[model samples]
Target chain A: MRFSIQQPALLHMLQVVSKAVAVRTPKQVLTGILLEADDNTLTTTAYDLELGIQDTIHSDDTNQLDVSTPGSIVLPARYLSEVIRKLPSDNVSISVNNNYMTSIQCGQVEFHLHGIDAEEFPKLPEFQSDTQIQLQSELLNDFIRSTTFAASNSEVRPILTGTHIQYTDGTLNFTATDGLRLATRSTTFDDADTHNWTAIIPSKSLSELSRLLPDNDTVIDVQLTDSHSLFVIGETYFYTRLIDGTYPDTSRIIPKVQRTEIRVNVKSIASAIDRAALIARDRDNHMVRLEVQGQKMTFSSSSPEIGNVSESVEASQKEGDDFQIAFNAKYVLDALAVFDNTDVLIRFNGSNQPFTIQQVDGDVGLQLISPVLMR
Target chain B: MRFSIQQPALLHMLQVVSKAVAVRTPKQVLTGILLEADDNTLTTTAYDLELGIQDTIHSDDTNQLDVSTPGSIVLPARYLSEVIRKLPSDNVSISVNNNYMTSIQCGQVEFHLHGIDAEEFPKLPEFQSDTQIQLQSELLNDFIRSTTFAASNSEVRPILTGTHIQYTDGTLNFTATDGLRLATRSTTFDDADTHNWTAIIPSKSLSELSRLLPDNDTVIDVQLTDSHSLFVIGETYFYTRLIDGTYPDTSRIIPKVQRTEIRVNVKSIASAIDRAALIARDRDNHMVRLEVQGQKMTFSSSSPEIGNVSESVEASQKEGDDFQIAFNAKYVLDALAVFDNTDVLIRFNGSNQPFTIQQVDGDVGLQLISPVLMR
Candidate 1:
């Protein structure tokens, strides 16, 4: 491959695809990024068998890129990144010899790298399904942020490490749980087709996709196959393998009846729980107790070796009977952090049952945490 | 002890002293910070046997602090810092009961901590020497930044891990080396005393002191004793134990005669060396070769597994014979980073002898690096 491109443009494309490069893998080709120059576009692709990212840059009126030949080569991602970043000039020229030795030149600096043949690199799986769903990048980003944190980090049950995503009618639902805690978010998106689909996407992949998604109203097209899913945003394509097992149904676990409910400012309760957590963190479960009486709620935690902490915040509204519950302080803090609303309504079914937290003003999302048994 | 102090003021004092708190130490009291409340000032101290830091807050015009009773206690540093940081109100009240159970109250929040008696905490050593040297904080900070990186990180020779400092007449010299490279910085300070003194201070302590020193010209008093050194900056006192060993003389390592001299732009050559280092870094020695001929200098490095890289930059002036030498790229980069000059003069004694780098216009500091013998 022989081509000359703007240093900044090439660097940006390399960084985007580098996210999928395999680190310390036995297969050396997986650690490389494939560069192909054809027609008026230069495409860069990186795949690690499980995840793949590809981006393309075009040579247009700006005259930032010039292609002298149509060819392809795979170069080590790490060294290529470093070389491109440290190149001295704005314009960089790259060429590959028949022996797969690549040369990169910019002004007075030149780097000759041993490149592997493009044939040795793995190709990204092609999506064969014609069915495609289009949604706003901002909505997808919010869904990932709201529910992914609740996914299981352990590999005991591999399916639990993924976020369950489903689309029925015009509603898109996202749910994740690690047995002790659950987070669910639902949103309405206009779609003409009535087809429904459900898939389990690894929380790790969802996080990377969220980082690449724009926060604005830009539309992104998503295609899902039986084993793989693909996301296309602008000129970039991201693909990830689907988890192989069925996700457990979590609807039954959410409490349907409430014995007590309280509405409190999110910041106030979050700060109180944070302070209590300082003591609770010394314990195994990071357990803290919450008691609701009249219009006040008190959060307390104690460690046999570190003393105790008690903090109270006034609730804006209270209903039903006064109650007490003990749960992990870290769970409540994580649930509270994803809320953009100032006030949240917390509902309790019983001292031992799971309690749910939801936005007081909107029905955007809900978080449920199971109480820990205390002697 | 009972006191009400502004949360911000107390937090600041805790942060300053907490730097000396021991982590994972066998002695329990070493992990706590000693808090002593007297007349109108609340003093906080933390000691890790080798280093100690103390700071005080007074109840004066701002009235941000109020002392109800005079007492002392030791509390865990990590937990106290977290609790104070998350407290809800500006004014926080702290008191201790006869049982050493301490209560921290702010607004509707309360934290009860098990405190240790102040007697268990190690006291900071008092400086017995009346002799003191006063210098500008900015100058001292610069001297530290110029020389400390050359200090040995390996404990094989414990004395090499400390920076040797000497004061004679009005000149203050700071020097550090790890056998392969040496850095020395000297400054002229106005001192009336004719007495000369030399001491070796641990590089870790110097690094911490550098972080605390202000960049502006503020006079700081430093006292050196037989076993300890005390630095008084405003209302804070920092103490560190002197390394109990004789420091090796490094004056003989700096070559006095030169076979080749070249003056080049620091930024241009630094950038070239940085790029060459990318290839050199794959090798054990991180060796990069530099060749100077006429007014141009070229930097190159090659690895059998990763190919090679070559970069050239123009030199403004060159004299003597043309030469080629190989050295660790990291050492040169670290030495070059400490220079504020736009251009540096490099002098070489021979291909095997050590070379020196200094500012082209001024002689504030000098760096000597030994070349690696290549087969």
Candidate 2:
């Protein structure tokens, strides 16, 4: 392929697709990025079996890209990234010979890179699906952030490593759990069709998708298939394989009754827990205890070797009987991070039952943490 | 000990002294910082056998510090740093009980930290030294930066891990080498005594000292003894033990006669070498070659598996004969980084002999690099 493009534009496109390049696989072609130039568009593709990313840049009125010949080549992603980053000029020209030997030139610098034929690269999976949904990029990002952290990091139960996403009526719900802790978020979209569906997507895929999404109100088109899902944002396409097992029913795990409830400032409690964590983190479970009495809430943690820490924060509102609970400090911190609101409402059934936390005035997000038995 | 100090001031003092705290030493007290409260000043000290650092904060007009009782105790550096960093108030109160159980209070949060008697901590080494020299902190920082990178990281030759500093006739010279490359910097101080002395300070100590030095032209008092060197910067005292070995003489290795000399823009050659290094770093030695013909200089590097790269930069002046030399690209990059001047003059004895690089107009810094024999 023979083409000349603005260095910045090419670099941006390469960065977007390179995330899918395999790091250390037996197949050499999996480590390369496929480049194809046809007509006025240049497309870059990278696939690592589990995930595939493709982006295209077109030659328009700005003349940022100029194609002299239509062809394809696969170049090693690591070296190509380093070369592009160190190129000295604004415009770069690249050409591939019959032997797949590529020459990249910019001003006084030139590099000859050995490339594999594009045919050797794996083809991205394509599926036929009639179900398509449109959602704002910012809302999808929020859903992913609120639930993904609660997903299981271990592979003991592969299904728990994926977030359960479902659509019913005009509302979308995302839920993730690791047995000990659970997080869920829901949002309503009036424009979505009434057709309902559910999918279990790996948390890693959702995280990567969140990073690629723009922070604006641009609409993203999502196509769901039985085995694969595709997300189209502008000229980029991100695809990931769906987890193959049924997700657990977490609805019964969330406590329905509360014996105690307290509303406190998010920053005050977060800081208090953070300080307590400094002592609690030395233990295996990272346990911190929270006690609610009247209008005051106290957080305390101690390690046999590191002494103890205690801090009290005044709750803005309290109701019902007072109670105490001990749970992982990291779980509460993660749950608190997803809320932009200043105040959070926490409800407890008992010291041993799972407690739920949510925004003081909205039902958009909810998180539940199971208490750990304290000695 | 009972004291109330501004959180920022205590944090700053802890950070400065914490650099000397032992990471994984057998002596438990080495991991703790010794805190001493006198009438009006609170002192913090940390020592790890090889290095000791002490800093004092006084209760001045701003009343940043208040000492109510005079006592001393040693507290673990890691936990104390974390607690002070997370304190919620500007002013923090610390008190040590008769049993050395310390209570730290700030705002509504309180921590009870276990502390050891100050007598258990290793005492700072005492030395008799009347030879004192005063130099600007900025100049000492410059000397450290220009020479420290060339120090050997390997322990094969322990002497090479230290920088040889010599003072004679009002001039201070700093030099370091790792067998393959050598860097030297010299500066003059008019106020220094004519009495001559030399010391080999570990590169690690110089690096830490450089970080603590202020950027302004504040005078620093340096006292050199037989076995230790103490630098007093304002209220901080930094003590480091000298390396117990004889340093090799590097004067004979720098080539005196040259057959080829070239003057080139530092940025142009440095950027070319940096780009070439992208290809060269995959090899064992990180080799990059430079060929000077007339006024054009070319840099090239190749790996058997990763292809090759070539770039040309124009030299402003050339003398004697055209030549080609190969050396470690990282060595040249590190040497070039010490020079802020745009132009540098490089003198070459031959293709195989060591070449020297220096500022085009000044004699303050000089670097010598040995070329590798190519296949």
Residue-wise C-alpha lDDT for candidate 2, range A1-375, written one tens digit per residue: 899998888888889998899998999999999999988899999999999999998897553798999999999999998899888648899999768989989999988888999999998888578777888998888889999999999999999999999988888899999889999998887754547888999999999999899988999998999988999999999999999978888889877779988888888898999999999874558899988889889999987777888999999999999888898999999999888758898998879899999998766589999898767
Tens-digit per-residue lDDT, B30-53, candidate 1: 999999998899999999999899
Candidate 1, residue A321: how far the Cα is off, in Å = 1.8
Clashes of each: 0, 0
Clashing pairs in 1: none
Q: Which residue pairs in model 2 clash with each other?
A: none
Docking class of 1: high
User: Against the correct fold, how does model 1 do in TM-score?
Assistant: 0.98
Best by DockQ: 2
**Candidate 2, position A370, lDDT:** 89
Model 2 chain A scores worst on lDDT over the 10 consecutive residues at A188-197
* Every model: iRMSD: 1.3, 0.7
